[model samples]
Target: MILPVISDIHGNLSALERVLEKIDSDRILCCGDIVGYYTQPNECIGKLRQLKAISVTGNHDLACVTGDVHGFNPYAKEAMDWTKKVIKDRNIEFLRNLKRKIQIKINDVNIMMVHGSPRDPISEYIFPSTSDSTLKSFLESENADILIMGHTHTPFIRKFGDKLVFNPGSIGQPRDGDSRASFACLDVPANEVKIYRIKYDIDKVVTAIGDEKLPSFLGERLYDGI
Candidate 1:
């Protein structure tokens, strides 16, 4: 089966719609943060639910439903506060029930999906700059052939020994200096993984953010992909 993996949607409805339109797959694995830091929270949630995406919970998602915004930055906290007021009750319930981690089998391969690292699934960042030693440490403890994580908002596929760790980056916000929506495709039968950087109209999302009275810089970040 070919599964599309997406993460950190952060509530950009335009980007999500574009990404879904471009990809044709059997299933989608979402690494969570379906809402946060942007506009159109309700729409994004509805789309994901409609698509029936296999997903896990993220820190931002946690903050929204649990009201535990303790670790969020000022900007994220602000957006989340606004999000709390705007999303529908059913969408909040959707977030409220998301699992922290998901363990599943895809084409005979054991796979684990989390919003962050397996050890610290909701907040710890696993980035490209993460040390080899740290990756090795996680590898030693992992039981799955593939570990899918998000939170760094950077797309990367890396190997630590025989274990593979992949992040599809941010769908709503890309901090990798590319103003593009990112996602990954995992071909289980063929054992192939692909990262896709998709271009969407940033102005659509930017205009919405500005109209919602979100921080101007948040709108600007979409243009710059900062």
Candidate 2:
């Protein structure tokens, strides 16, 4: 089975649409943060709901539901604040019910998907430069063949012993300095993972951000993916 994995998202429906259009898998695995940092929160949520993407709760999703974005930086907090005001109750309900972690078993392969790390799903970040033990922490309890996570908005695939650690980066607001929507594809039986950086209409998202009156930084950063 080939599974398409998407993460971050951050409420940019244009990026999401572009990424989805490029994906050819039957089922999509979403690593959370479906809303926040941009406009079209409802539209992103609606698309995810329509696709029935398997997802985990992201920090932004929790913040939107709890209305507590105290730890987020100024720009992120501003977007969260704006998101909470305009998002519909149904979308809020969706965020409220998101899972913290999701585990899937295909044939003999076991896959664990989380927004951050398996230890702390919603807040922890798994970076490319993380220590070995830190990476091992995610696979300590569950013996998953593949561990998929996202939060840092940087894409990388690392092999820690037998576990394949994957982060598909961000769909909406990428911080990798590439300015392209990031996603990944996982082939189950073959035990292979492929990453993709997609190009989209940055102007659409930027215009929406301006029209929505979100923080200027959010709109400006979309062009550079930072």
Best-fitting candidate, scored by lDDT: 2
Compute each candidate's TM-score over C-alphas.
0.95, 0.96
Q: For candidate 2, which ten residues in a row score worst on lDDT?
A: 133-142
lDDT (10s digit) by residue, model 1, range 1-226: 8889999999988889999998897578999999998898899999888888899999999999988899888889899999999989999999999999898986668788999998999999999888777766665576677888899999998875556778899999999999999999987666568999889988988788888898878888887888
- lDDT against true structure, model 1: 0.88
**Which pairs clash (backbone N, Cα, C closer than 3 Å) in model 1?**
none
lDDT of 2 by residue, 1-226 (tens): 8899999998889989988888876699999999889888999999999998899999999999999887899999888889999999999999999989889998988899999888888898888898877777667676888999999999998876557888999999889899999999988877778899989999988888788787778888888888
Worst lDDT 10-window in candidate 1: 134-143
Off by over 4 Å in 1: 160-162
